[model samples]
Target: MQSIERPIIALDFPDASTTRHFLAKFGPDAHLFVKIGMELFYNAGPDIVREVRAAGHDVFLDLKLHDIPHTVEMGMRSIARLGVAMTTTHISGGSEMLQAARAGLDAGNNTRPLLLGITQLTSTSEAQMHSEQHIAGSLAADVVHRAQLAAAAGCDGVVCSALEATDILTATDKEFLRITPGIRPANAATGDQVRVVTPAQARKLHSSGIVVGRPITQSSNPVAAYTAIKQAWNLKG
Candidate 1:
């Protein structure tokens, strides 16, 4: 997996104007990798992606689509036209749905966006997985299984917690992307995430990329927070 020098900032804002304002905090020379999750995407629509790209940043469209294979395929076709660098779907949707989604991306553009399967959400605790989801295995096992399923279905990578990346990466090839969320710096709040890791921990685990939100986006000095996280992530032995 290619190393992501800069952390992917989550633009978990309410509207387009706020999102734009947040990105502007990094200034014109910063070439950022930003995530437009459900809140922002649903509110701002697809045009916000174009606007961000036009500002010289890469977009990770995090709608996390999960549905019947045909529905996901059609939705992905529409998503492909937006020209994002990455997008996600639920791996629990199974191999057929993953394959269908890939087919749709291939149909839409010669260079499809990176199709990342979400193995397990960071908010889901192991106890919750067993009680609520009624899964029979460890959360790590479940995450690895879903990642393998995604790999077999031709997905480029998976959106997993850094806590599970090592196991998932061991099951898949080196080139397979492991883009982890639930990342907080050592000094940051954990928020609602249950499997949070610091930037240094994620980098040590060899994660392909790390997605961070509040530590940067909600900080009084968003740019400084981002720079601190970036420095931590790139710190050498």
Candidate 2:
């Protein structure tokens, strides 16, 4: 297996204190991607991104912006000012929104954040997808379609489930990163995530990275959890 030096551990916590506590436990050597979701972002704002970066960890602002072209562009421009390493816009938001976000990133003239398109969420299931969301076609087919839209819109990658990674790799070029979430190691509780895979399996399927939250964050010993996962990905090497 290929060795990954630093796996991006998404800090999907509710508050700053919880985030800080986890970071302290993990220590500075841990390669992390601090995911600032709605709750934390609403509370901490752009300052959270700055603080995470100040601590030498890359920040992935997971706002999952899904609005009109102009609004998304303006929002992306504002987010870009925060100096995050990556940001997400929903592929379901359409090509225009994605394009606008990309343009906003270009306008920043700063270290460009890797713009990823959010495909099917890890929490979604086929029944919910068809009945509730009213989306036609199979899940894998939909993911591929959205990924295509993301690529056309100049997104650097897509946030997809590991199950869809191989298909995405086949459909797109190697440079188009596939950031898969819903990663649960063997024997770990599945929790709310429906589409799950092991770290090694995800890597083998050609996923560029995997976003693991509760499995690491909710563990009794967060460091041990992270290390175990890192080892699973062969990052410990």
Candidate 3:
């Protein structure tokens, strides 16, 4: 919830031990908001989630669940049990699925995680959008549409690109959280992400938080890279 350290460091490593090793660089005193995506969560299981929670930091569990309402609801019962601070579902699954997912969270045994609906992945390009998904509307428009649905479903927010955050805010509540990914620091390689922006740009555009993976995780000096990004996010617009 701190304004300065908005980077939710993505723990994209293979397992929890490697995650623990990488995070150890920040020292035992540091408290970070970490992301446990499919690779690490699947390999390390819920014990990894318990370990991360026991350390006093928060976790954003990014499984991007998309399934029938009943199925998603059942899955969320288990996901909510992890007591993560945030979690994601695909808006492409529609409002029924999202509401069911939220209901399951309400039924969960632990603190409710903020539920964010994924609009479109940052790695997805316009070409891929039209060619594969057959969506002729601009990608940003599609993102906004998905975000709108998220709001109607009572979701806490949407996961979109910084490029779309301002536009999404125009249609949704200012308090509705925007969790933007694809944050590549200035001068960093874009990698697989197509709609990347710097942390400063995302903050200026009013993103609630930015999900940064390789920019910090791959750096030789991860703590320094993470610190630089936090400083950038807090800069005056």
lDDT of each: 0.92, 0.84, 0.90
* Model 2: residues with Cα > 4 Å off, grouped in runs: 1-5, 29-31, 235-237
Clashing pairs in 3: none
Please name the candidate that would achieve the greatest TM-score relative to the true structure: 1
RMSD of each: 0.9, 2.3, 1.4
TM-score of each: 0.98, 0.93, 0.97
Over the stretch 1-237, how does candidate 1's per-residue lDDT look in tens digits?
Answer: 477788999999999999878988788979999999999889989889989989999999999999999999999999998889889999999899999999889888636899999999999999999999999889999999999999999999999999988998899988899999999988678989999999999988879899999999889999999999999988875
**Candidate 2 weakest ten by summed lDDT:** 1-10
The deviation in Å at residue 181 for candidate 1 is 0.7
Clashing pairs in 2: none
Q: Model 1 compared with the native: what TM-score?
A: 0.98
lDDT of 3 by residue, 1-237 (tens): 323255899999998779989989998878899999999988999999889889877899999999999999988999999899999999999999999999988889998888999999999987899999999989989999999999999899989998999998899978788898999889999988999999989988878899999999999999999999988987875
Residues 173-199, candidate 2: write the lDDT tens digits.
888988888888898899888999998
Better of 1 and 3 by TM-score: 1
